[model samples]
Target: MSLLASGSLLAQGSESKEKEMEAAWQAAQSSAQAGPATVKLGEQATLKLPAKEVFIPQPAAGKLMHAMGNLDDERLLGLVLPTGDDDWMVVAKYEPSGYIRDDEAKDWNVDDLFKSLKEGTEAANEEREKRGISGLEIVGWVERPHYEAASHRLVWSMSAREKGQPADAPQSVNYNTYALGREGYVSLNLITARDQVDANKPVVRTLLSNLDFTEGKAYADFNASTDKVAEYGLAALIGGVAAKKLGLLAILAAFFAKFAKVIALAVAGIGYSATKWFRRKPSGSAEPK
Candidate 1:
């Protein structure tokens, strides 16, 4: 009877997992957009989200939560780039609600935002702890926020280290960039380890500049009388708004997957010894080389 019960439980677990994969696959296909073409950014502009380089433009955002297996609330995301090469992926979405004012960019303070982000990370760690996972800490920024008035572009990056990770241990970064439009903006995030950011930076910047904002939808087209302006400005966009966590962390889970081994040791409550046990031998180990 005990054996039968165990078998039944296993069957249920398998069925549940199968359903999840099917659901993820279907969702991914539903929102998937092929590249080398123009995709309207909610009436504000056109995005030439290319799919070459193993990049799949506008992939199903659900796959990032399910198939990728880590997240913090990515419901706002409308598009994703699943780069088959390495564990890197890019997420982009357009918020067309209104225009984001950049006047505050002139005196933006990094020290304040850094402090706010650390506090925000501490709060996020609480949730991680409840899930029997190791927590995280906001060490510092890999790149402080910078805004270019000419192009109406903003760029910044932050680094996070696992709780108890050695001081010299490697960290991950979310290199974020944004292009402001008359209606809203398009944020493109390159989720990767700190070491990989330099290599990936150029490509992502190119991607940002190539995104075409249609005429009358460009930042210069803002009509003060008729256009709605965002309640907050650039400073609020970079730092937390109202002391709440920056929505950026939601997608930072993409970095967690990139460093899966570190995540196993850091977040999953797993130790190094378990790795050896799970390691598989080469299929031809018994044969002569």
Candidate 2:
């Protein structure tokens, strides 16, 4: 074949591979919510993997880490999985933090916590720079730390943009909630475009409600008499301790990009880059009717 013809064929082949990868990614996501499954979340809790939603149990979580990228987390239980049912969907992850105390919740101030997060993230950026990763700037609270003392559940989010991105650039946020048990807490991480938190919250709420603490492991069973309490309190989970892990949360972006054939379909589905999925007027929380 002529040199010109050979180049054209190579270009066509590259395009074909790209299209194939996209299709495979879509098919994997569509299969997520296909078969219902149950994953035992440690000895304390259980997750109900509803129909059509994929659930990666802890055993296979390593497979994901391999496919996605290096996630610098040690407490990772597993990802709750995302369904390709919407333009964008929230990816929830579970991490078990054994028996944290809520005592500090009373004395904690939201402003102080915010300051710590800012300080901690700014400090983390130094390390990120050393590693050649882009710095992340905290844009402020999407949802301030809200702890439900009664249920032992906490929900909070921070708006973050890649350093130096345009003000209105699409962003990423993690709306985290925890189901505190007698042993440790189970963290539910909802990762998605910062703009789609509202659209994806109902599903998040459902997932939180459905995560059940098995017998002898419910937070109510906390036997101060016999239970082992974590050294950190609820405040640390939000303020200092959390800031470190929050720095690495952006790996989800790298994860999607690395496997642009699978979860990356949100971009094509919405006619935008994967980063800009669910572009809309950003809201701190779901707008009221």
Candidate 3:
């Protein structure tokens, strides 16, 4: 063939290949958007799985499955499985916040909490051994950090539980604790009844897994700021009343302080209303009120 003819043929082949590749890509994308099918594990129970690779089991009969995702940290997922018998299973995926500093009392307290949890596990194991129970095991302790914004505090929780307990039997529980700035603080003996412990794990795990620690910063800051505002509001209210009673500048200051938030809120509302009104077109005909 001539060189020009050969070049033209090659170009046509390349264009055909590109078209095929584009078609294949589009097909794959469509399939991905279709999502996974729902599967029934037991009577009246169903599980929804994503079209992606993960293949989680469908829930069994009489079990309710709950799932929540972190708003900021999309990677975190929490699942709660509540069995009708009051038994629960919780699964969480996310690192707890904060670290245990050596100088902090909270650090030492957390250590003691873990020690107590271990003791509880050992005791439960001993009891199981004495009873010659098979398949009974202490699954060790799990700890995570929980933050309380109201107090600007962080709690390190260490939980211990016995696994493979009979469905009807009580579960063994032991826990350790630590606070953000406190040390060597041992918590009181808090025990979970066997049945209750079994029932709570699923819920707790689900809650943890679904938590979005990344998005929590805004909420934490909002809470702290709001507390200060509330304090000021209360003071302003009191001062306003007192000033009115005493005939002092308290009334002016009180009025400004007491209504600051309300006034700001009203202004914001009015601005929003005006914007909406401006964007709307007038109706052609007036309707009767």
| lDDT, candidate 2, 100-186, per-residue tens | 888878887899777767767766666566665667777888888888888888888776766889999666776667788887777
Q: List the residue pairs that clash in candidate 2.
A: 25-262, 32-52, 32-53, 32-54, 33-52, 33-53, 34-52, 98-184, 99-183, 99-184
Top-scoring candidate (lDDT): 1
Model 2 quality (TM-score): 0.70
Rank list by TM-score: 2, 1, 3
Q: Each candidate: RMSD to true structure?
A: 8.2, 9.0, 29.1
Give the Å shift of residue 244 in candidate 3. Answer: 50
- Candidate 2 at 243: error in angstroms? 6.4
Q: Which candidate gets the maximum TM-score versus the true structure? A: 2
C-alpha TM-score for every candidate: 0.69, 0.70, 0.21
Candidate 2 residue-wise lDDT at 157: 74
Specify the poorest-scoring 10-residue window by lDDT in model 3.
61-70
TM-score of 1: 0.69
Runs with alpha carbons beyond 4 Å of true place in candidate 2:
1-37, 72-74, 87-96, 241-289
